[model samples]
Target chain A: MDIVVKKIVREVKRGNQDAFAELVDLYKDKVFHIAYRMLGNAHEAQDVSQEAFLRAYTNIESYDENRKFSTWIFRIATNLSIDRIRRKKPDFHLEDQVSGTDNLDYHSQFAADIDLPEDQVVKLEMQQWIQDEIMALPPKYRSAIILKYLEDLSLKEISEVMNLPVATVKTRIHRGREALRKRLGQA
Target chain B: MACTRDKQQVINQYLDEEMTLLESKQFEEHLHSCPDCEKHVRELKKTTAIIQSASHFEAPKDFTAGVMDRLPKQSKTKRWQQWIRRHPIVLTAAVFFLVFVTSLSAGFGAEEEIVVRGDGHFIINESERTVVIPEGSAIQGDLFIRNGDVEVNGEVAGDITVVNGRHLQASSAQISGDIEEINQTFEWLWFEMKTLWNDAVPFLTPASEEE
Candidate 1:
């Protein structure tokens, strides 16, 4: 698989325009999911996905072949997601069920559009609550956690994506899990 | 006796299964004896499970197309422009080289044998690898002779560039333009680049044409 991906990348470098579509097809879901998980917005996630792939395509020559292509692309996506998160300044602050009218409106509107059965709605609400908890994390810990458990990246791969030491990534993942546990009242 | 503080750090590592076998056995033993650590580990598992399972999503169906549409059109013509934009010094040097090369194909290649290529009419002796322009014969456009000789005894309207070759022009040869003889290396590279550029130019379509 690595060889096939590398071959496609080579073809793209040689100006075979069609070859890049293959690469995009391969990593789009991963890139999109990372952005979605990070931003909690599908629209922004799609935008960030396109931007990450664009950056990767444009800078394909700069990509070091010695490193994994997934890592390189994920790093670009991760960094861009972080930048967007910081820039947007998330407005939905769901402090509690009583506070923040905009927040409750978002939740209610979220429920209305789905139109799921009762149990499914309850499940989705739980999922949304968990998503909110994940989003509440600081970007640094959020990236580590998302990459590790959400994206299923190993500690070393997470470190490569975050460009941190493996030990540092481990600590961040530990902290992120602990944070989530506390937020969900599991502790 | 693993206290709650030290065991707290171990709980995460244990959940991630980062601990070695013996270490895990010892932690499991500690967990069985300690209900607090066991509950903490279980909750951590629940948290990770919710994160992984709750939000698994794929990109929209039009994702690949959207990415392709937004792709920058780095076409053939844009290649040199992009290069120049990146390396300003290359632009200056390229301008100098182009001016120097266009006037006369100065990038000389090795192989000093006769090779002639052009649309201009010329008398050719294949065995000798020598191109002869018969006296009073009108030769149109540029002529390139490489690795051999050219006997120009006719009228040439443009430059005659010879690479690693000889030119024997008769006294009566009415040449309308400069004749340049370049030999080996940088000239070879320039020759290759020119060939590549010429080949690509014919297939190059305007960006608007693609749409």
Candidate 2:
């Protein structure tokens, strides 16, 4: 997959604009999920995800092919997500007025493997509750927690994406989970 | 005494799979003895699990096309900036020529006093540090004014650069080229560097190639 992605990146660097769509297709869900969970709004997440792909396309020349592409793109999405989280008023996402159908859109987008409707709905509510808890933490801890667990990045990867030391990333994840634990007790 | 901080650190490490086998073994043993740590670890595990289990969403179907649409077409400002970056030598030389011509036309003897260098316009108030081109007047070349406020009520055919000063234009004032005000030290240094670059990089192209 890395080889395939590198081929596409080379094409993009050579001025093949359409070739960037493949990269967008390859990493869209991962990028969108990180931004979605980080900003807690589907609309903003979608906007940020699109922006990440556009930036990756424009700056494809700067990308080092030897390194992992996921880390590079993930770094861009995470930084944009944190910026959006910090610059906005706190009252916004609490009401989370991102279209009435954001959750519905998620359901339709992932409706492929619905084994049991009853079990899926309960699990989805639990997931939503957990997402709300993630949004409640400060932006720094929220980014650390989401990247570590939701995005499945290692401590080293999170450190790279956040441009912090590995030890700092570890501390952030610890404190973030501690906060999540107390908020999650209602479940 | 409960080692809560140390145990808490390992809980996150353990959940993240960062613990080595030896650390994992010791932590498991510790959890067996410490009910408080065990419960805390249990809840934290559940939280992280829920996070990992959260559903992922695909970008909207039109997202790629949307991005392609908004991919910036270089604006006029960006184009000039790119031109400046691509041919720094030519721009510096052009700036050097400009300063040389300006100082020559303004005359060496007019230092600190009012010196307005243009083809032909009117009014220099040396006492007030002001120059005025009254209505119905026009200058054929670039205007270089030093340490003086300028009021242009007429038209000029070339650039207007005010050194360590400011320029005000009347409603009827017209300039065919750029208007530059150099009062800050940073812009002054840029002006100086352009003069130097003109000397060093004249081989790249003529000074007018910047246009």
- What local lDDT does model 2 show for residue B126? 80
lDDT of 2 by residue, A1-187 (tens): 9889889888677655557778887888889888998888889999988888778877887888998899999999988888887788755333343466655433344447546698778887777787778888998999998888877788888998888999999889878878887877436
lDDT of each residue in B75-149, candidate 1, tens digit only: 777566555665899889989988976645433434334567776678778678688998878767778887668
> For model 2, what TM-score is found for chain B?
0.43
User: Model 2 segments beyond 4 Å from truth?
Assistant: A92-121, B1-3, B13-23, B73-211
Report the Cα lDDT for candidate 2.
0.80
Residue-level lDDT of model 1, residues A1-187, one tens digit each, is: 8999989898788766668999999999999999998998899999999999999989999988778999999999999999998898547543445454544533454444646799988888887887888889999999998898888888888888899999999889888878888876452
Best candidate according to DockQ: 1
lDDT of residue B153 for candidate 2: 95
lDDT of 2 by residue, B1-211 (tens): 1257666666767877777999899989988999887887777777767777777767778877777787766567755765676689999999999997675445323356766778986799887789998889998878988778899999888889887778999999988888998776667667767857877888666855454
Give the best candidate by TM-score: 1
lDDT of each: 0.81, 0.80
